[model samples]
Target: MSTEGRSAEPVSATSALESAGFVRLVARADGDGLAASGLIASALAELETPFQVTVGRTIAERSARVDPPTNEDDRTIVVGAADAAADTDDVIRLPATDRPATLEAVDLVREIGGTPDPVLALAGVVAGGSEPGAGESEWLLETAIERGLLEQRPGVAVPTSDPIDGVAHSTRLRAPWSGDLDATREALSDAVDGDSDALDADDHRAIGSLVALDAVGADEATDATAESIGRLLRPYATPDHAFATLGGFADVLEALARTEPGTGTALAMGHDVRETALEAWREHGRRAHAALSSASTGRYDGLFVVDVDDGPVETIATIVAASRSPEPVVLAIGHAEAALATREADSLGATVDGVARELAGAEPETEPAFEDGSEIGVEYDVGHRRSYLRYDPDLDNSTIIAAVREFR
Candidate 1:
């Protein structure tokens, strides 16, 4: 009942060890300790012959001990896991489940065993998962050819029927392009209609991914579907979410632009969606720049001002407002606004909104609050029970805020 290194595959733990020539067990303490340990202990229990189980804490330590020539027992071949180290001629390396070492480990194992069958070794490494480190075109081709999974050509390896169909089906499933566009639009819209702020990166990406999937179907309704899908995606297109990593949505937009420029325009939400997506890519740069600029000023990096009016900001504001007393209202302001607001908030008792130019300033209950900026507001019940009056863009500012104050 050892939990260590147990493979889900039906093969007995001793069988896996015997296949690898009972070479040293190489596993990382952090990476594959549990799984590797299970397999090692299982082999020890099943084998009639005696072999010592040596645990290498680090990759360097493991590499130093795994050489067959230096080992005191010629009969004992070490089996171990390592993050990374020089490969030995006699050692068989199993990739750690988490953060496994380089793909070179596969070649290293094959090299030691004097067999070019990477599929067998990699199957043992990945267990049930797809072969590791084969996502790239070149790597996939090389591995496929080397393992006789693909027909080798001058430039690329030609996948056989199984591989070709597998790739195509997997791609479709990943993007799910066959869904009904109109139905998808309504369902997604309803999901977010209640609270766009509730939508996170994954949600937005799902919307983009739906659009991609719809476009792939290329049905008679595709022209209309493209436009409707774009409209649905409009609100979520911010500098965040990275605009869908694989760019299937962007490709869909480009294809739509050729067929229906109007839909493409709407997809852009009246602005260039590609340009905005590119800017989203630049967000990391902006954050890095902000981090570097603020680093020298002895400023705390943890504090960021989210524009309380922003869709995501509104979700937090709702949570804070509903939260128990002394819970600080969250503001979603821009980096520049955060910098300036932190400076002026103490003096003015408020921060101003960049887009609305409204004051989110605080004042005594007796004093009148600033107008216009009430659209983005905060509330708290501490000390004087000051309420930063505001509106959820979905509702009327006056009506909602007034109803909220009625509770106080």
Candidate 2:
């Protein structure tokens, strides 16, 4: 809530690394977070700089994950953390921004005299999910085109397998046939022929039109539905990455980050882990789809609560908040952990981190309590739109519901 001490000028990434005896890079366990951290780590590796990379929900957790504890002379760079600040003297923070952190990392890598892999850099931008209209997104795409890493093409927006599977698995478009493979296939029968692994321009347009029709009937607001359709119909900036297209690569990164963050980070760092990452992504999609389909949901004043026995809570929460839930915010609670996601248009203005702290009874004066083995602690994410909370296994769901109601 307080902005004081958060606006101090950030130290140059090059300077921070050059001045430190050693470096520790901490990134949130998300696609963009891993991409940003991986970009910096790749640059550092190229320079032969001693560094370690750790991934977690928060900076504290990641920093603590480092094996050989950092000393006074070591510099810790924290990226994609909402709670991080440029003013933190002991740590260098690359806080989230409208511009993808990957782009920022690219600049830093260049400043440090390391050439970033064009594909990896573009993947970072794609993983960020910035709108095509965004200046930064356009710049990144144009750069990719100039570097011959991407080609413009007309295609359906769903990044999944074929047209049918993509429509069924699409999180943005909540069609009537959603979650029903048979129904989806039947609905696309007229538009798509036998196997749609490779679609022509006519097939793309036909499929896009059907998707738009579905979006119009979605439960979301007209503006939201229109935005979704626009994105769905937008020109594809096809990438030459291992994952094929830009959107597909982003989806793989996202799925890997949620299911196997280590693999995601390795992939982002130009490692030959594509096969492993793809497998992890498929498993993640299976688990997430199952959890979302079976989950019970409750609508509150300003929040939508989803109760699930197990699965990826963060992924489920994000999907619910983004497309399914009518509420401005969503909370998905599983047996061991919980995730909160806020709609971009939310008017409450209360940050997820603030709500989480309140729920955990963590006072500003005693902030360190979160790191002192507290049973309930908030995990600050890379952006204000989401937060993760870990609570005691025995904690009652009723207590969480009550706290969330009070926060609303």
Candidate 3:
């Protein structure tokens, strides 16, 4: 096995990866994540462009079973770079509820001489990849529909939760055009601090249309459903962060289930499955909380904050933008903004004007809210900060669905 601190040329998959728009990272099965990361860092200095790697497989198989008994050997070879460093430390934390841009992973790959092709799509389906018996396609349909990134249609899901909307089709995860991780990250962050006035108008409009959908359809979904929708559009959302955002919703929903027995029954799942979802949500909460604590202690590489202001369109836009710093940015805000972020996104205008307009809805005066609540905006809404989102909204739910379908 190649020893750590030694340089090695990239593997032979370079050509194949070029076609797939992915870079291959190769790590020794015995390496630790830090060591692997160190080596990849060196390799990145020698590559053409940035890249991301998959560490070759899910986390479970990487740390154990790959040693002698598994026949693969115990090297911590991250499949990211053909020959970069890898180990337990570089884990893509169990994502809260959304998919990652593959930028960070790709950066590691590129560091090890792999090309970085940012993956596009929300990651709910891929997150399930690690779970046995999890249906990737289902997550794709469910989360995407929930987010309004995909329109509920015939094959995709129960249209409108009414079963009568007939057909469903979602926006594909892969953008018709290439999506840049940096650009996406920037836009997402911008949304966090956005003044609402400056947001690409499309973003605002898109958001507006979505919340309007929820308000319009609020009568259709059970109270739980409407609340569920409200829980998602947090002021601090990015595509990948939805995972954490959902955890809170899941928690509230769970509490709701305990209070309303019929709600859980309505899902029509076995007890074991319910247990599993709960188990996952618990883990999600724990992980997010842990991340938050780390950020609080200044122990991480990103900016993590729970205080986000919602007001003058410009103020909100500014806050969202600031949250996108590469440093981890954890945010907290209201369900109004959260739901608005994920719901009816497709129906909202996909232009700058549309996006900016949506920010206006956060105004207490403009939309529905509890009494005594600020009508135009909520200052430092804690509900928006989620350890998982860190304000990077580039996830394409459709892309996640596509990958899940491919894997399935």
Candidate 4:
């Protein structure tokens, strides 16, 4: 197969696989990337096609893991990493956008004359935090419900199977009862009856009222409190899988990817690693809750910075951005890596990726991590709403802080 002009035109995923001598699949380690990889891998198995899937967070890291195709017939499909298109022969380039990569993978599977798995797609939707009642997310959600891959019901949006555990681990709702098992159970006593598998509408309403009351007592901003309550009351998408709900599965994927990329990839590739994933999720929630509780926070002109000693930076950053802070952008920084997240339904008049690039450019030693395997660099996520920066001795936290202040 001639490789010239492949990047300029749109090539069907099916055509690339059929023509390639060997197929190398590179995916990011995040939830959307994992779901996309899993979806495509299943399709390849159905077609009896041999392939390899390499998962990593940054495009540079994932691309570096693959050797250049030895033969012209060999092709590589890069999923959830649009920037990788320039690196080599990308059979498919799904850019990071509001639309999750798993949806794009579903379309590709359909093009390949295979049925897309709705369960994997549902995981991706929840992981991507797709807006409900709008656009493709709504369509995919309806399809999942119709296919029985997901059951829609009125309930609290917490991901855990147990209501008490769910309330305790909830990052969106920061009540006095949060992170305290006894407090959480006491808070839910009136709303819950027996050990129910799921929460009913009345239970949800009661819990929402309590959370609202807590917010009011704490003197939270009216708009921020309302958003928190809305998120808490969103309808639950329960899945008939190892995990209880779609959000729970998404959390597992994220936790595993941050801590152990290989384990996350295994779980996403239809492996029976539910127990392992759940353990990781539990540990992750515990650490995140502790980090949030003890975080030493600083305020920048356009950023809310949370100093974390140890924890999942991305998860912490996302939580702070979505609920804990009113700033348009939030940064959670640790010793090794830092993650920057933008608030939902808001923007900083620029993409986080652009901001990261600018920051990298500000320092001569710092470079864009996705472009090369630099020890100190920045990587923007798929949605352009968040970015991660790998810290180096030269590019320390102080340097990043100063650069960000200058940029802002």
Give the Å error, residue 392, model 2: 1.8
Name every residue pair that clashes in candidate 4. none
**Ranking, TM-score, top scorer first:** 4, 2, 1, 3
Query: In model 3, which runs have C-alpha deviations exceeding 4 angstroms?
Result: 1-72, 77-275, 278-408
Higher-ranked by TM-score: 1 or 2: 2
lDDT of each residue in 263-339, candidate 3, tens digit only: 32222111223444333333332333232222221112322223323211111211222222223232233223321
Write the number of the candidate with greater lDDT, choosing between 1 and 4: 4
lDDT of each: 0.29, 0.66, 0.25, 0.66
TM-score of 3: 0.22
Clashes in predicted model 4: 0
Q: 179-236 in candidate 2: lDDT tens per residue?
A: 6778888888889888776777787788878877775766543345556456656455
Q: State which candidate, 1 or 2, has the greater lDDT.
A: 2
Worst 10 residues of 1 by lDDT: 152-161
The order of the candidates by lDDT, greatest first, is 4, 2, 1, 3
For model 1, residues 252-298, the per-residue Cα lDDT tens digits are 22233223333333332223455443323233223322332222221
Q: After best superposition, candidate 2 residue 252: deviation in angstroms? A: 1.6
Off by over 4 Å in 1: 1-22, 29-71, 74-102, 116-140, 143-208, 211-408
* Model 2 regions lying over 4 Å from their true place: 1-12, 19-22, 66-74, 82-90, 97-99, 115-126, 158-161, 165-173, 176-183, 195-198, 215-223, 345-350, 361-384
